[model samples]
Target: MGGVLADGDRVKAVVVKSWMASTGGLEVHYQDGLEKGSSLKANAIQQGLEEDVHVSGAQDMETVVHRPAKRSKVQLGSAPPLTDSARLLARRKHCRFWENSGDEMELELLAAVGRNLQPGTDSILLGTDSHTCNAGAFGQFATGIGNTDAGFVLGTGKALLKVPTIIRFVLDGEMPPYLLDLILQIIGEISVSGATYKSMEFVGSTVESLTMEERMTLCNMVIEAGGKNGVVPADETTFKYLEGKTSIDYEPVYSDAQARFFSDYRFDVSKLEPVVAKPHSPDNRALARECKDVKIDRVYIGSCTGGKTEDFLAAAKVFLASGKKVKVPTFLVPATQKVWMDVYSLPVPGSGGKTCSQIFEEAGYDTPASPSCGACLGGPRDTYARMNEPMACVSTTNRNFPGRMGHKEGQIYLASPYTAVASALTGYVTDPRDFLM
Candidate 1:
C-alpha cells in the first residue's frame, strides 16, 4: 500500500461501497481489499473507502512519493542546484500551441476542447498562471512551462532536458487554523519564479497529515515558485482524501534510491501563524498583522487555486467571525461547475448539504456565480476597469500582474480563499489570524 504503482500494474482489489462528489469529480466507495480498477474509479473509491481493499491502476496514475534517499541534510543557499536533465526536459515539453497561434484569440481557441473529448491532446504546458495546472486534475502530466521553455516547446515538440533535483517538503503536523492562507503567504515569499526549473516534491509528516483539499492547495502552487511540478507521495492521507472521489487508481510515486536534492526546507506547523500577501503580487509575503490597514475595493475568494471545498470552508470561517455584511464588492467564483455544485448543493460532512452561496448570502455577501476562470484570466466577471484609483483586491488567482485583473491601474493581491473573505468583510487587506481565536 505504501509503494509506487507501476503503469498497467494491479496491486489489489476493492468493492464499491458508496459514492461522494468532490471538487475533482464523482467518487465511489470501495471495500478495503480489492486491487484493480480504473485510476479515475480508484480516486473516487479512495475517498469513500471506510475499509481497506486491494487497488490497481497504471504507473502514471500513481502519485509520486518522497522518502529521504540520502541522510545528509543540506543548508539553504542563494543559488539553486544546476541540473542539465531538468533543463532539457523543460525545453522538450514547452507549449507548442501558443507558438503556432500568432494571436490571443487563436490561443484561446486552442484551449477549448469538444464537450465529450479529453482536453489534453497530447503533452500540456505549465504556467505560474493558476489555470495552467488545471489540466493535471484531468489526468495529463500538465504543469507550468516558463516563457523561455514555452518558446522552445512552441517551436518544437521537445524542449531541452535537465532532470530536476527534488526537494521534499513533508507535512507531518496538524495545519494551524486557516493554514491555507499560510501556504499562500509562504508561496508568495518563494515568488512565482523562485523554483523555476526545479522539481519541488512535498513530503513530510505534515504533508501526510493534510486532507486532499489541503494537499491540492499546496500542490496547486508548485508553479508559483517557478517549479516544474509540485507533488505529494501517495499515502494514507492522500488515499483517504482521494478515496471514493476519483475513479483513477491512487498510485504513489517514490524517489529513486539515488535521488538527489540540492536542499530541503521544513516547517513546524505548531509554530505557524496566519499570513497574507500584499497587493499586486503573489510574492509580496508579509505578516497579516502588518497589512491590516490596507483598504480594498474587491475581495475575490475563488479560482482554481482557492475555489475548492476546503477553500469555501475556510472563507465561511472568516464570514462567521466578521458577523456582518461585506463592505466591498466580493466575488466568489468556483473553479469548476462541479465545485460550485458540491459547495452549493451537495451533501457532505461539515456542510450539512448547505451550499456555499447560502452561507455567503447568510453572512451578508453576494451569492457566488457559476464557475469560470473569471478574475484569474481577466474575464468579464469582477474585472478591473479603472486604473490608479488604488482598488485593492485579494484574490485566490495565482498571478497578480499589472493588468491581470483588467485595468493596468487596478491593484491585485493574491491570497487563499480565507484571506479574501476577511478582506471582503473589512473592505481592506485584513489578516486572517485575528479571527482564528
Candidate 2:
C-alpha cells in the first residue's frame, strides 16, 4: 500500500507520530520488545524481530514502509528512541518526544520525520492519539488512526481515508479576557459532534493576529470536536514562524477563492467571556461567572493547549498583577524543557518580581520533574499530579472524563490560563476580573 490518492479525496499529506517509546498504545509493543532484550539498529525503522518480538496480531507483519521522499529535504527518524532501540541507544536518544507527550504530539513527530518538511506537501498522521490532528496547523492534511492501522502504515506507508467536507470559521473580534478561552467558546456553540468527520479551517484577521503557538492550540483541539483536522493556510505569519524551524524548500499551500465548504460560521468575539467546561465533557461549557462560587482543591495549568509561552505569560501576568500566590495546590508544568526555562525568564511582581517560575517556586507551587502528558489520562494509578482523594480541580488540559485525572471521585473544570490562575489564588472557581488590581 504505497502512497496513492483517489480522485476527489481531499487529503494531501501524511504524518507518522509513533515509535516514541512511551504513552499511547504503541507503548505495549515498544516496551515488550525492550523487556525481551531485543535491540534494534541505530537508524533502523523495524527492530528486525524474527517473529514479532512485541507487536501482536497483524501488527507483527513484515513490510517495507515507503515514506514519501518526493522532496529531498524532509527529515525522518527523529522520534524519541525506544529504551532499547539499539546498542547505541545512549548515543542516539531523542527523549524530546517523551518529554512533550499528551498534546500537540504531531509537532515533535514532524521533526523526526525529516530535517525539513517541504512546503505544499499533503500529509496524513498515523497514530492512536486523537490529538494527531495538531499537524494540520501547518497547512498539511493530518489526522489520527488506530494502532493496527499505524502498523499497517508502518509496513505499507499508505492509508485510505474518506475525504471530509470542509467547514470554515471566521473569528472577528478583540482578544477576550483570555485568548485561550476562544476555542472553548467555539466548542460550546458547536457541540463536539457538530463537525463530525469534517475539516474545520480557521481564518480571519483575528486568527492571523495570533502567534504560531496559539494557532497550534486552535488546531490541536479539532479532534475533540470530532473533526478530521483543523487548518490555517500558510501565509506570511506562517512562513516567518517556520523560517529556521525547518530546512524544507518547497511551495506553500493555501485556500482558493472558489473553495467550497459544507458549512460556515463567523464569531464576533467582542462579547466573549472567560468560559469553563464542567466536569465530564468539553462541550459542557459555561461562562466562568456561572461557576465562580465553585470551590476547587487543586489547579493545573499545563498541557499542549496550556504549555506554550503565551499561555504561561497570561497566567503569570495574572499572578503578578494580583500579587498573590495560590491558595490551593497549584501544579505548574511547562509543555517543554525550553518552556520550563522560558517561564523563569518572565518576571512576576511577587517575591521582588522574579520570573513566574521563580515566583511560583518561591510561593511553594509543585513543579513536576519533567513535562509529559503524565496526568492528563489520569486513569493510571501513578499518573503525576493525580488526585487520589475526592477533590475538585481547575485544569487547562483537555478532557475531564471520569477518572481522567486519577480519581473518579474528583471533579475537573476546564478553564483558560487566566481563570486557572485566578481560581488557584482563591481556591475556588473564579472570574479574573474579581481579582484584578
Candidate 3:
C-alpha cells in the first residue's frame, strides 16, 4: 500500500487530508487493497507531505468498510460565501497555552491559538457556547462541548458523536433595525432545547450581506436553541472578512443536495421588530410593549452576546433619542477592550462628533474593565439590590435563570442593546418601537 504508517510506543500516520487529525492521527482513504482494522506504526508511514502530521492513541483507530458518502445530493448556496479553508487549516495545526489577561489580549490570544492548531486534531472543546464556533471559522470541526465532554476530550482523543439533524434557517429581506434583538426573540420562541442535537444552518441570499460579526452573532446563539452546532457555508463574503490572515488551502463543506433537513424556519428580516425577554429565562420572550410599566434599578448593556459594535450603535441611538439621562444606575461593560475602543470612538448620538466615552462619562454611567461578564453572569459588579426592590434590568446577555444577574429577588429583563438603552433612560421597561420610529 502507498499509505505510510509508523509504529513506536504509540501509532501515527501520514494522511493526505489534514482534517482527519480528529480521527486519531491516522488517515483512512481508498488507495490500494487494504483490509479494515489494519495496523500501522509511527515509522512505517511516508513523511514529507505538504500538510502537518499528527499522532493518536493506538486504541483510537476504527474502520468503516466501503461506506458510501453519508449524504447524496449536494446543496449549493447554503453556506456563507466567505469561508477561508487555508486559515482554518493554520488554526488547527498550531497549539499553545497562553493567557489572555485583557479583552484585546484575549482576542489576540484566541486568534493566535487558532492559528497554531493543525487541521483535523481531535475536535477542540470550548467552555463558551457561541464563540466556540469561531474555531470552526478555522475549519477544525470545533464545537462548544459541555464541561463533561470537554473533560473526556482532554483525556482521550475521541468523542462519541451522533450525527445531528439540521435546522435550516432561510433569511430573506434586509434585517430591520435592532436585528440582534429580533433574532433573540425568534430564538426565545424555540426555548433553550428546541434544536438540541441538531445542526443549525443559516442559509439564503440575505446572509451574504451580513458582516462577519453579524454572522458570528447568529451562529453563536445556536446554543440558545440547544443545537449541537451552527454553520454558515463559506463564500466570497467569508474570504473578504478573513483577508490578510494566514492562508491555507481549503474547500467549503455544504449539506448534500439531497440532504434532508429535520426542519426549516423562515424569516423576513425586513419585517422584524425589536424584541425582549422577560426575567429569568431567554425563552420568556415578549415584545417590549408588553413590559412597559416594569421599573428597574439597573440597566446593563454588555456581554459576549451583546457587546459587539452593532449592539453599541443600537444602544447609542436609543440613548440619544431619549434625550435624557438614565434614571437608574446603568452599567455598560464591553465584551472586550477592542469593542470598547470601537464604541468609545463613535460620537454620541446627537453630539457634534463627540464620542460615546465622553457622553457616557458625563452622564454618570459606570464603565467597568474589559473582558468582564460583570453582572450578566452573576459577576461581582451588580448584585441583586433588594428582595422586593421591583428593580428591572435590560441586558443583552444570554440566559435569565433565577439569580443569574446577581440576586434571586431582582427582576431582570433581557433585551437587545437598543431596548436596554431606552429603558435605562426611563427607569422602566419600555418598548423600543416608539423610539425606533
Top of the candidates by lDDT = 2
The TM-score that candidate 1 achieves is: 0.63
Better of 1 and 3 by lDDT: 3
User: Which segments of candidate 1 are over 4 A away from where they belong?
Assistant: 1-141, 145-161, 240-251, 347-354, 380-390
**Cα lDDT of model 3 by residue, 354-387, tens digit:** 6676666665677644655566667554443222
Cα lDDT tens digits, model 1, 234-350, are: 555544444444453333446676877766767777677566655566777776667788788877766667777668777876766666778887777776555676677754346
lDDT of 2 by residue, 98-134 (tens): 2232222334334222223443565444456787666
Error (Å) of candidate 1 at residue 4 is: 53
Of 1 and 3, the candidate ahead on TM-score is 3
Per-residue error (Å), model 3, residue 326: 1.2
Q: What would you estimate as the lDDT of candidate 1?
A: 0.55
- Please name the candidate that would achieve the greatest TM-score relative to the true structure: 2
